[model samples]
Target: MLRIFYHTKYEFVRWWRVAAGLTLAFLAAGLISFAVTGGVNYSIEFTGGTLMQLQFKTPPDVAEVRSALDAAGIQGAEIQQFGANTDYTVRARDEKQVEAQDAGAEGISKQIASALDAKFGAGAVTVVRTEAVGPKVGAELRTGAAMAMLIASFFTLIYLAIRFDWRFGLAAVLSTTHDILITLAFIKIFHIEVSLTVVAAILTLVGYSANDTIIIFDRVRENLKKPHKGETLSHILDRSINETLPRSIMTHATTFSATLALLLLAGEVIRPFAWVMAFGVVMATFSSIYVAGPLLLWIEGRWPRLDDAATARAVRAGEAAAAAPRGADRVSAR
Candidate 1:
């Protein structure tokens, strides 16, 4: 092997520098966005509202249906079509409060039906589906989601520590947090609706972030058993990184490709989620190889031994020490 690794030290070094600079910039932007936007503007799940998904026998008239709801005294109600099909999702404050007449999905659906009936006739329209999630349920969901994310971060940190080292785990967790911040920053900048679906996407991205970090850490651990024990720490890490880089690139590339396809093909309802994943995979890839892996060397004090030979040398030296002490006692006994 013509030393495939460490062949482009300058390139990797510059890459690391740029990555660090970009990370700092990202954090700054997140802070600014947080200050400007006041953090994630959570959807009904956090703000207290009713989510009613509806399906009609025929594609309903958006303007007429909205007008009917407005006439019924509903406020801040949103109606949008979903999928390539003729389904619609309606979200609003408590239907009772909005309409002020003990309005539930039952009542709202009837009004929507009546409105559509006027447009398309009674037999021509049907309320095929209806769901009602109260504001109280939405609040509980928001609390549950936050708790789930915190718990997930905790468990992920623990897993990284147990599997590799505490430092690696901490960095991995931090990197995941970074990914979340960037995702939220995008939401803020774009003014995207931070709905329950978005929360679900955030949690899923957390795991995706951890998975990438774990892969590189696992490689570092394996390299620890090799014989190149006396190599420089940066060079050793560079080699380990190079060895795993292909797999990381391939995995993220495939995911990115799929997410891009979804972003292009899927409805706007799903685009935000797909966009988050697409962006997250790229960040996760870099953090795993650069932040999480390189962090071990920097934090624990690097030596040039992130390879199998380096590990073998250490093991051999330990064994020799153990045997030598015993041999000296035997000689004295003689």
Candidate 2:
């Protein structure tokens, strides 16, 4: 098996300041974009609308399709060509059509299909799929998605607190929060449509980032138990990260490959999820080393663990005492 970064002593936490500045700048840019662009581009699932996938026997003019929908009073519908020239997706999520969906699930979709059929001929167009969401249901779904993320974060904090010290828990939680913010920024800057699948990707990112932090922290905990008399916490953190560098590299590389495949090959329906996941892999690795490590050091400085030194000394004394008896026994036997 190939080995890389074996026994390396590289100091990863030394660049935390650079990482912090970049993170802040990116987030600020995302905020400015949000203010300028009027917030996230929510999908029909969370914004209430009718979505129709239509297939035609021959290619149709987008302007003609728009004219037909307008002629039938299905105004403000968004039309985009899908995979092939003969396939298209129609989104009618205007307030009027959203209100009309409350009357019947198929009301807006039927109107769209009828309008297209009338313009192109009855048998030329095929309604492949239709999704209708009512305004009230969309609002509920949006609320539910938000709540799901909040609840996941809350439980993750609780779990980390139970598994590690309060300082480590707080640092890990904050790191996970940073990952989410960065991801949202990426989505906003690129205008990735917010959908349930994208929400799932964010949730997955939270777990992935937290897990990486936990791995490094767990190593730090193990190292702390050993005799390292004069090492500062930052040095210990650096050692821990260096020790785990190979594993981190392998894990991230494999996961990123899979996500990249999805980003390139997955259909449009899942493309947003893939985009988020692909970006998340890199962000998670960065936060694990830069964000979580530096936050932990700062936290330790703010609330110094007074017992840690005493505990280390005691461990060293105990080991020395244990060694004395063994050495004496060997001497006596010789």
Candidate 3:
């Protein structure tokens, strides 16, 4: 078996300042993005626009499709080839532009489909599907997405508390929240549209972040029982993290590589989701070690009682002693 090497005595907890700095930086960028974009630049799914899927008998040239749409005065349209080179998905013009077009979103979709068919030739292009969401439906979806994220976070906190110590739970929750904020911040910076898929990715990231934290916390608990006489809590935490470093690296690297592949090759329809997932995998890994571990240590500093893994071991030792005496006394009396 190959052994993974790490500095068991290294003081990772002492570098909390580095984690704090990165958090502040992400928050600042997110705030700037908020001001610049006038809140999130939500995708058609949340802002109400037309989505059209078209298929061609032969591969269609993207530049030709763009030219046709431009000639038809459809500005700000987003288009990408999906699945096969011959199949393409086109988003209608931006919400403001689509709303200004007479009639409704369906009218806009028909116009775009007509333009593509004209460019390719009669019957060369087929409209596989067209979807139009209204403003009211989008608003409801936005509200529901927000509520879903909150509910997930709430349940994660509850589960961690029950499974480990309350301090570990609190630290895990905070670290998970940090991952969400950082991912959202990058979404703003990159102009990745906020959609239902992205929301799902964020929810998945919450669980991923929590699971990683729990792993490290569990190891910390196990190590506490056999601490060397002179070892400090900081040393124990560093040791625990080092011991689990190999497993964490393998899990995180595998997920990160898969998400990266999606971001690069999955096309624009899935790009927002992929970008968020890829960004999230990196952030979750960092928080699992830097943010979650340091927070646990910080809590340990403020309230030592919350970090009492040794208490259980001490109780077990006392019970064994009591039982041994009873057995020995009975033997002597007999």
Clash number by candidate, in order: 13, 0, 0
Error of 3 at 181 (Å): 0.3
Worst 10 residues of 2 by lDDT: 325-334
* Candidate 1 residue-wise lDDT, 1-334, digit = tens: 3244333443242255567788788778877877876866666556655455556676666887787677665655788776645677666665454332234535655555565567556676445555444556666787898898899888887887787656556767777877787777777767677776777778888999889877766765566556554444444556666776667667787899998998899866688788777777777776776566445544433222223555545434553124211111100000
Instruction: State the RMSD for candidate 1.
Output: 9.6
After TM-score superposition, the amount by which residue 14's alpha carbon in candidate 2 deviates from its true location, in angstroms, is 0.4
lDDT of 2 by residue, 1-334 (tens): 4375888989777788889999999999899999999889998999999999999999999999999999999888989888889999999988989998889989888888888888999989999899999999999999999999999999999999999989889999999999999999999999999999999999999899999999999998888778777676777888999999989999999999999999889877789999999999999999999999888776655445544565444434543124211111000000
Steric clash pairs (candidate 2): none
The candidate maximizing TM-score is 2
Listed in order, each prediction's TM-score against the native is: 0.71, 0.89, 0.76
lDDT of 2: 0.86
Report the lDDT tens digits of candidate 3 across residue range 30-95.
999889777776877687778788889999778989999988878878887767888888887465
